[model samples]
Target: MEYCSLIQLKTTMMNNFLTLFIAAFVFISCAKEKDPIIGNPGLAAQGEWSIPLNRILDGGPGKDGIPALDEPIFVSPQEATYLDDDELVIGHSSAQESKAYSHLVMNWHEIANDWFGQEPVAVIYCPLTGTATGWHRKLNNQVTTFGVSGLLYNANVIPYDRNTDSNWSQLTLECVNGELIGTRPEMVNLLETSWSTWKTFFPDTEVLSTETGFDRSYGVYPYGSYRTSEGLIFQVKDSDDRLHPKERVHSIISGDYVKAYRFSNFPETAAGIILDNVEGQNVVVIGSQTQNFIVSFFEKQINDEVLTFSLPSDDLYTNGNFTSSVILTDQFGNNWNAFGYAVTGPNEGDQLTPTMGIMGYWFPWTSFYTTVDIYGEQ
Candidate 1:
């Protein structure tokens, strides 16, 4: 299945979403007659926006135009034949469970609202910017599902909570407008990597099913040539030409500082580890081009002790090489998985402290943090 051209995508979106936006405008018209303010107008929508209003582009589809998935379906790794090995996925995992949201389904519907055990989570992806994050589905203890506001800031998705109609900037990691202004959504750390690498490491993982209720081409990318092209469909607030705009990078954000860690900086021929620091936080980054993965975790352990990590030795574990995503062996002999969870050792049940990290295209991260730092850059 080939990607829908810009014309075809817009036509399809219009066909599916026209009625939803029609109703929105109707409500706005009625609300405007009674008072100057309206509810979710799809035009500056609501509240005094934290971002410069001029920067918010009118992403063609109006509110709920590009539908978000609710109560998404999932299948076992073997059942996910629609995915290819090299294709990437955003993973949200824990000791109890692990799930992979493939880019194939995400390209059509950018958000998937689902439950991971008892807690609600919204897997938010911005296809244009190639950024994905898992947001806890709650605000001040009240549960809510997020929807596509049909808006773009820095060419990234602006998700609004159904409970309060507040708009959130995915890359900015905060609410920029509406009732929940200035509030930041609680986030779950998500690891991004290729399907081959993920399924190899986590054979028992649940993959997001292509059986989404919406009728979309599951394997085809909706946006044409956007992934490889240097052009952005919408403008960003800031940009830097140090790296190709679409080159994917793992970013660790702390307070006001953001560090971009590239796969090129690590040894690609074989799995490698980089013990580094980001904004005073010691970190261990592991990756390999052969494995098609790169990930990071805070070096501070659950016991509050900082430990040095290295590639597993042949003599230590079972046989020749330590395969799977058990990419690190700490001095204490704990083997840590890509998700930062300890799989073996005295602290076996404990999880490594996760940093505020996300993987996305280089431009989006740089645009968000104008002063973004590139590791190994001279």
Candidate 2:
């Protein structure tokens, strides 16, 4: 599983370009012209190499070999017997339709391409990095699909778009190879929480069914020991020991600035919220340590008045039917859910704008944002 030697091999290949070219020419001459190359040949010359070419190793699967779920099937929460209550899921809602992509299913396929109303998107989860993100599939007016490139960068997944065969770094959110090098895709907010929390909040939610066309174990994790182990299977260009290599964190990035909040640092037992100014914009993070979940949103504004937030106190709800689940209350006394929707009070139908962020391991987040500021550290 160790791939550190690949870096040395790549260096040797680059140093002896004439020999490599002669070998490639001889092999191509013997092969049929009709045979297609596995990846874009132009990619080798494009984009800044974050790491040496040789370090990007094949992850035991070929292009689209991991199979993204294009036409996914779903079952209601009550009927989703495949999921354990504590299992992780990525929840997305659009036009009143809620869908849950179980870690059980994503652990194998890694990516699911589907439509939320008319908006086409790809739900991507990288087990190695503990990252889940939603990507808008439309690029330059054309709807595209993503598949596992079977490549790894910084020990994280690299997905390639079928429209242009360009390899994209999931952590960097940019195309590193092919014709679309340096391009970035629009990101959508995806709520990462436990299956129980999601089901409790969205009882009518549709859970991804195990009846996907591919034949594989649906509820079982394929990567044994990797999830809990400290060692990495692939090589990365840099490393940081500021935090545990695999410690999970919620990170917010704006331009080149990044701020990370470790789950352990946030009071798990208290009903409180963290408010901070990131990149000059007000941001709030709320979560329950007991429930094992966290969510963040940008502060709301009305009539040019920026609103501040606080957790609801028992005295504020003495006459109302509020519960501990209602974690956020704005200065205007509006109660909001974890997803930032106002369940009651003056802003009943209004929803706070969810900030762009990711829940991932410290290693990959720091590798991409080396100078990231960690909350609570001077």
Q: Worst lDDT window (10 residues) for model 2?
A: 316-325
lDDT string, candidate 2, 40-87, tens digits: 343366565544575476777777888989899999887899899999
Off by over 4 Å in 1: 1-45, 301-305, 315-322
216-289 in candidate 1: lDDT tens per residue? 88878888899999877666667789999999888889876789888798764667788888877788787776
Q: Estimate each model's TM-score.
A: 0.85, 0.82
Please give the lDDT score at residue 214 for candidate 2: 90
Error of 2 at 302 (Å): 2.3
What lDDT, from 0 to 1, does candidate 1 have?
A: 0.81
Look at candidate 2 and tell me the lDDT of residue 265.
65
lDDT of 1 at 139: 86
| Candidate 1 lowest-lDDT run of ten | 31-40
**Top candidate (TM-score):** 1
CA shift at 161, candidate 1, in angstroms? 0.5
